[model samples]
Target: MTIHVIDTGFFKLDGGAMFGVVPKSIWNKQNPADENNLCTWAMRCLLIEDGDRLILIDTGMGDKQDAKFFSYYDPHGDATLQSSIANAGFQPADITDVILTHLHFDHVGGAVHFSSDGSQLLPTFPNATYWSNEAHWDWAVNPNPREKASFLKENIYPIKESRQLKFISGDSPFANIDFIMVDGHTEQMMLPVIHYQDKKIIYAADLLPSSFHIPIPWVMSYDMRPLQSMTEKTNVLQNAVNEGHILFFEHDPIYQAALVEQTEKGIRIKERAALIEFL
Candidate 1:
């Protein structure tokens, strides 16, 4: 099995919103903000190759939104979804499965794209089965006001329309992969724990977006239930530390992956390294 880091690009978000209750005095040290208090974040994705099945996890924000919409959050970078896929020596048609951590715009936007002349929406990976939980799928389609803006219909619906959507139960389909469900970030956000090359790697999707967010209290304000996020983080971190599991970060720009350890200041990142080191 081989794993490749697919960097779609980097974008900016309000540092305060990304760090929740954490004071700017602290998070600012980690991700220094711009003049407007927005910190640059990577729309990093992962592509896993196990035999013939090429699985893509969490497509980054696609380039389909209007300029006005993109002005709010600065999306800038050279890497794109297609380029990243090709970097792995494959194309969108090669992806057999797309495991979405959640349906937020940034995470799932690249799953679909606009057709020629921007008239119709189409699935980016026309041959792949796009994965999402039943619960989260319902929640995103009928979103509340707080999250409605993040859940855009253009990024979704097209998969179902294209007849390529698959819902994964919170269980392993094969010996190589397993799924974990967490609700704090969004209802039933699915995180994939893959048994790769004699090592287990957890795709810490919004649950632990970056190594900086490893601390229990550094939860994101965007989460619907902050307390639930704490519970999820504690449990996942504990298990990761116990087994020495490699954590694949989705949004962290600098650190690709890391190992966790219980420290003087609760659970903290032990070492940051590339995912290839483990493989």
Candidate 2:
């Protein structure tokens, strides 16, 4: 099995929301914000090539939204989903499965795209079976007022409408990988832990967005249930440390993967490394 890091570019969001309850004075030292008070973050996606299946996890905020909508997030950077896939010597048509951890615009936006004529939005990976659990589907489609803005209907719906939406077996979402269900960040947010080439790698989807988020209290305020998130963080961290799992970070700007060590300071990141190192 081979894993590829797909760079979907970067976008800006308020640092305060990203790091809940954590003082800006501290987080700024980690990822500093711009003059407008928005901190830049990478929308890093992952593509897993396992035998005949080519599975992509999270699509990043897509480019179909209007300029006015984009002005708020300030999406920047040269990396794009298409280019990243091409670099891996594949095309959108070749993608067999798209596993969306959640329906947040940044994570699933790249799932859909505008038509060349700008008349309609369509699935970005037209040939792939898009995966989302039944619970998250309900939560996102009928989002709470707080999260409604993040779950854009245009980015979703089109996948189902295209007749490609599939539920990861309610029995178990993970086929070869283990599905770690985390709810503190969102309802039933699924993280995939794959046993690849002698190492176990967990796609640390927003549960641990960056290496800076390693500390226990550093949970994001945007989380619906911060306390639950804290508990989840502890569990995942301890397991990662004990099992020697490599965490595949989705939103970290510079670091793609890292391993955790139970440090004196309650589960600190051991090393920041690239994804290719594991392959």
Candidate 3:
């Protein structure tokens, strides 16, 4: 089995929103914001190859939104979802499974795209089964006002329309993969745990978006339940330290993955490096 880092690209987000209550005086040092206070973040996805399954963890924000929408979050970078997949020696048709962490635009946007003639929206991976939990699927589609903007219909509805969407429950069909459900970020956000050889790699999704967010209190403002986010993060971090799990960060602009250690200051990043280094 092998895994590849699929970097769709980078985009800007309000640093304050991303860091929640964490003061800019502190988070600025961690990520450093621009004049407009927007910080750059990567829409990093994961591609796993095991047996006949070519699994993609999350699809970054696609380029389907209009200029007005794009102006809000300046999405810029050379690496695109298609380019990155091709870089890993595969094409959209080669992906057999797409595990959507959640339906947030930045994470699921690339899962669908405009048809060649721009006549209709369609699934980006024409032959793949898109995985999303029933709970989260419902939460996104009938989104509360707070998260409605992030859960764009164009980024979601097409998969179900294509009849390729499946809800995950109990054990996954894929070998060496397990799902961890956390509700603090959104209802039933699924984090994929990949058991590779001797190590367990957790796709950190929005649960622990970046190494900087490893601290219990650095919850994002976007989360529906901030206090619950802290509690879930503590439990996940404890398990990560105890079991020597490597966290594959999804939104961290610089670091791809990290290992945590139980420090006197609570769990903290032991080292941050490229995902390949962990393998």
Scored by lDDT, the top model is 3
lDDT of 1 by residue, 1-279 (tens): 878899999999999999999999999999999999999988888898888888898999999999999999889989999998897799988889898889999999999998878889999987898888789999999999999999999898898899899787746554587988999999999888989866889999999988899999999999999999999999999999999999998888788899999988899889898888767
Clashes of 1: 0
Instruction: Kindly list the per-residue Cα lDDT of model 2 for residues 1-279, writing each as its tens digit.
Output: 888899999999889988888899999999998898788899998888887899999999988888999999999999899999999999999999999999999999999998899888899888898988889998999999988888888998888899999887556544577788889999999998888868888898999999889998998877989999999989999999998889888989889999889866678888888987755
In terms of TM-score, how similar is model 2 to the real structure? 0.97
Best by TM-score: 3
Better of 2 and 3 by lDDT: 3
Q: Which stretches of candidate 2 lie over 4 Å from their true place?
A: 171-175
**All models: lDDT?**
0.90, 0.89, 0.95
- The per-residue C-alpha lDDT of model 3 at residue 209 equals 87
Instruction: List, in order, the clash count of every candidate structure.
Output: 0, 1, 0
State which candidate, 1 or 2, has the greater lDDT: 1
- Candidate 1, residue 106: the lDDT equals 97
Looking at model 1, report the run of 10 residues with the lowest lDDT sum: 166-175
After superposition, the stretches of candidate 3 with alpha carbons farther than 4 Å from their true spots are: none
Candidate 3 Cα deviation (angstroms), residue 181: 0.2
